[model samples]
Target: MEDTNHKQSKFQRVLDFIERFGNKLPHPFLIFVYLAAIIIIISAIVASFDISVTHPGTGEEVVAKSLLSGEGLLFALETMLENFTGFAPLGLVLTMMLGIGVAQGVGLFDTAIKLTIEKAPRAVITYAIAFVAVMGNIASDAAAVIVPPLAAMVFYSLGRHPVAGIAAGFAGAVGGFTANLLIAGTDALLAGITTEAARAIDQDMLITPIDNYFFMATSVFLIVLLVGLVTEKVIEPRLGKYDPKYAEEGILAQKQEKVGRIEIKALRNSMIAALVYIGVILALIWPETSVLRGEGGVLVPSPFLSNIVPIIFVFFIVVSVTYGISAKTIKKSGDIPVFMASAVKDMAPYIVLVFAIAQFIAYFNWTNLSTIIAVNSADYLQSVNFVGLPLIIIFILVMGMLNQFITSGSAQWALMAPVFVPMFMLLDFHPAFTQLAYRIGDSSTALLTPLNPYLIMVLGFMKRYDKRSGLGSIISTMIPYTIALMVGWILLMIVWFLLDLPIGPGINIRLDG
Candidate 1:
């Protein structure tokens, strides 16, 4: 027992160190501010060296330009406002959030989550929680807040370990964050950043939100299976039987609110509205003579794809408003704007962070630093002959490690996409493929990070059942899921690579091919 206690103490010390380090880091907003200043200084230093690289696509000599130079200062002063307003992700995220905000405000997301798990068979309860949690990401961060507590209630009612349910829900909500069956705000946000980055190499390149649709859609099932398996087979068994004595007073007596008839009616009406919306879209794009079709009637890169964000916005408005009216959440048309405004209000922090990131990316591009770094990095990789699956895996691993400290996927990608997307493009890999790889890495370690706010939230929920629960207890329980997901996702990527399958509509794995 002494030896076991000693080993556990050492493990706890390591976790404590990681938490301290992560906590010492500044907010993501401040990090970007610091990065913007550092890049300005670095650009001046590199420009003084007169170093340059030949752009692989255009064969043009790209030299680093100093932000301190007169021309650079003028450009920065002139483009500061344009950089923030014209940041691709700014409008995309806000537009999608408007619709999502309505859906959440109307209780559509909460009702759907309850209906999914409350109706599940006892045998598949674990799987249901995992599935709903993974799919719930379509509702955005609200899922992270809503799923775990409800899942724990469901688990406790069924005589299972409530902490196990929390783990499953958190694992699916965060660890499987990037894998969803439908195109979500994350798709638009990430694609916008990727498009901005890819333009560093191919100025005309535009990455659509659906660029990784096929891969992400397929990954949903894999994540659900892995999360369910880890929860039932490993986590539950390790947790053993739940003892009510460990639970806080009155906690066990508290019951989850059952889905009422009004919610069910609202969900049904919303589904009908969603189906009608989709049917109208299909009718508009189904015919060769349809206006939504491309120049040659191609669906990909067509009017339908180009206008996907608007379509998503309108669809959400229609369905959510329908549900809101049916559920009495919206008494008047004026209430719609109120909900939309509230959503944007929640995005205030994101808006501020985007301002910082936009300036950083704009400065990086103006200085030609992105192109210079990408070209030389691509050259070095080629020199070492690291140009295939091995290189892709290494990149994914690097992203996973970075995610430990930088928990925000968009922030990390915004920082990384500028450099890595173009480098891979030079290596003849598609920007979509690089983005897909980044998602795999970014998501696989999400639950393992001490910096993840949702992880701490889950820890708090766990302590209600076992007051002794701490960060170490939650982290240790999550380790199995994290390892299984990372390995499983990497293997899935290997298969996708070997198959050379189209990741999305008309998006290939390799650029030249």
Candidate 2:
């Protein structure tokens, strides 16, 4: 007991230092503004040096375009408003909250939680939550917004630490984001970029979104086990026991009505409505003649997949409204608009943060520094002649470290793929293999990065439990999972390399192309 207390005290000091350091920095919005300004200055300096890379596809010279130039300045002024509006997460979050807010306001989520916990075995609840969070990647942005709070409610109902629940959910939703049992929106997005990069070298190279499906599916189990172990053994224990006496006012005193006949009926009706919505979706896409199908009768690049965000919004709204009416929590249609207004109101801070982040991303792209770094780094790696498993391991490490600053998986890949994918193909490695390696690195350290919007979003969730919780607390809690995932993923890559395993459907470790 004494030793444990001593260790915890030391850890607390470290957390305190981290919190102070992070707190000393500007707000997330201001940080982005500063980054944008820095990019402009750096762009002008780099552009003067006459640095450029040859586009492998067209042999065109890709030069760094300085944001300080007249054309660049005009572009920035023209696109400033468009950048914020065009930012993907902004719309996704706003629309999702509209649907989720109705359910949340009507107390459907609470009743549902009570029902789920009453039947689920305590021993596997942690694993189950983590698994569902991992699978929620199929819904894109929906998982990030919905899972953490739901998990926290579950833990609170079970007399466990809410922070631990949110942490586990965060780990699954964001940390294990790259690995899923089903093909996710990210898969299609990255695969398209990879194809563009690969075609730069070999026009005949073909890659599908499912290029890493087998490996990613296998990895879901590993993530579940690893996250479950960390949550139960490390996080929960560190949090110690949950005491109702010390919990927030009304948090425990607000008596939850046990799942009764009325609540049960509401749940049943909501589930049926949800099933119907799903059926309608399936009916739309079941035949090649369906409008949802993309060109050549394929699902990839389909309208259905591209429009999944709105589908999620509609699904949640329909189910929640059904439950609210059945449960008598919603007495009128006016209540829904109220819920939507409240939901967006809660997202005010996020809106402010997104504006600055959007500008920063746009400025970075305008500067072309990311592309230059990726190309130069890949060329340097090639010049070193590092090959085989060692090269694979180092590549993962470098990518993982870079993830701390560049949190966008597709953006990072867009920069690196044109260089690494073709270079790897020249080394007799397959594009799919290289893509998988990049995915592994991109995901392993995502939760540790402050630049990740989801991490910031989860911090807001965490504060509901501990008012003092900050970026440091969240990052410290997640460090174990990040390290474990990185090491485990790297080892998996090594095993795949040694066994000469196919990473996906007919995709081997190396290809002649």
Question: For this target, which candidate reaches the highest TM-score against the unseen true structure?
Answer: 1
lDDT of each: 0.91, 0.77
Q: Tens digit of lDDT per residue, candidate 1, span 1-513? A: 999999999988876777889899998899989999999899999999998988888888999999999998998899999999999988998999999899989999999999999999999988899888888998887778888989999999998999999999999999888888877889989998999999999999989888999999999999999999999999999999998898888888988999999989999999999999999899888999889988888887788887888999999999999999999999999999999999999989989999999999999988999999999899999999999999999999999998988889999999999999999999999999999999999998988888888888888899999999988899899889989999999998899999999999889999986
Stretches of candidate 1 off by over 4 Å are: 1-7
Worst 10 residues of 1 by lDDT: 11-20
